[model samples]
Target: MSTMTVKRAELKPGEVLCSYCTARCCRYFALPIETPETWEDYDHMRWYVMHGSCAIFVDEDVWFLMVYGDCKYLLEDYRCGNYEDRPQICRTYTTDECEYDNDGTYDRLFETPEQIWEYAHAVLPPKKKKKKKKSATEVSHQKLPIVHI
Candidate 1:
């Protein structure tokens, strides 16, 4: 019997806390969003969220819209370019609402694209084309199943 091992990545909390790295999170991480539901609505959402590095989030009562881009003042060393005179939001940001404090887990929550799709799909109708049943002879003859759309 072969034993399989799955390796999990370890994060450095100290590196996140002590290092003055470029504000990568602010630069590239996405905002989450809450949406109105309709097939058309979801179709539009599918179009939008299907792109590179876009995400939607719903946490408790809050919603977020995420897009990938960097903060204007983020420097190469992970230091805030304007640390001394950072914007009010960044300056007042508390670790309490931070991913670092939370170990960046959407672990308790569904974080990936597929997870969100499953949630959305549950609320929507089945998207797969309904297939017509075939006789055993058809199977033996290698006939493709006919899909009824």
Candidate 2:
């Protein structure tokens, strides 16, 4: 994609500039991963993060799992439809300090499933549990037995 550049002030010049960007950051797809304390949780995240276009990022104190996608209003030229009344967050955002600038500044950034798996494995040992099998007689025996006094 061609990088479109505008003056630093032009980033938030009135509402038009923000609208022009069409809230690209907010529009991108993302979901939160439940707190990953256990290996299984991290393993689940590994599968999720490995899918095409997927990325995991953390900001401030929160973790976000994301997939890259464009905004519905991002025109062929990358402009917004309603520039005048764009959301306040977009209006206030400055490209000077943005993802486009630093790419992303997550405290921890996991770019791939392998990266997540490695982190999980390094911290947690691989332990698998065996499933217990129950036969029909065993199942019936566990039920309340008839009391014939």
Candidate 3:
């Protein structure tokens, strides 16, 4: 919601969006994860977020694990050092989906392990407790077979 921002479709002639960007996309990478189906799955997500440099986010019903790290090829001037030899993924990127001027907040963001666990507790059913097993000394009563003193 930047007042001084212009959408891609509304950009004036001879304007490049990447020049105005601070290389936001180069600062992090996000990978989609399977929807958490069980408490253990949620716990796994919690573990991922606990690493300190990553987070869990839900956007448009899809879950993603966002890892924050600068690409080694990124230069100090916010430009890629290997632009000529960049990977195919970077070559295929387009500005249409860029978040340079747009607010890139996800629908739901979990930045801490406790936040993920709390979400699991809120959505998942209570964990079932296991029944305690009786010891051998607590066997059922029966006729005494011992005869020797």
Candidate 4:
């Protein structure tokens, strides 16, 4: 995808964001997640990535499950439909420091379950299977008496 670059001195921050054709910030949302350490944790993360438009990313040791979907308020022209009554989070968001400039800052990213699973296998130790010994009853062919109700 081609990114729009503008001369910072010529336009204000709002104008810079407005001139950008694609609303990169509104295209996705990320929820912070616990770092996967165990097989089960990684398995759950794999399940999350298996869903459509879902991905796992790690930025600065913090993990997040990124869901790729356009914001409901975002219009076709890359503008917020409810700019006047936008949410507090949106109001506080500044274009000067946004994801658009540092889209590739993630330390690690997993777009698919296979990728996460592979990384899990690489980092986690292989599970050891214990051999079960034969029971005394099976070896001696002896059975316990059954109680009648």
TM-score of each: 0.52, 0.58, 0.82, 0.78
Top TM-score hit: 3
lDDT of 4 by residue, 41-94 (tens): 999999998787989998889999999999999987788899999989888988
Task: Indicate the residue-level lDDT of 44 in model 4.
Answer: 98
- Residue range 36-130, candidate 1, lDDT tens digits: 46555555555666775665656664555567677777766656778898878787776444553244434223435565567768887777776
Each candidate: RMSD: 13.5, 6.1, 4.9, 5.4
| Candidate 4 Cα errors over 4 Å, as ranges | 1-4, 7-14, 103-105, 130-149
By lDDT, highest first, what's the ranking? 3, 4, 2, 1
Higher TM-score: candidate 3 or 4? 3
Model 4, position 109: C-alpha lDDT score: 89
Candidate No. with top lDDT: 3
* lDDT value, residue 107 of candidate 1: 22
lDDT against the true structure, per candidate, is 0.56, 0.69, 0.86, 0.82
Clashes in predicted model 2: 0
Clashing pairs counted in every model: 14, 0, 0, 0
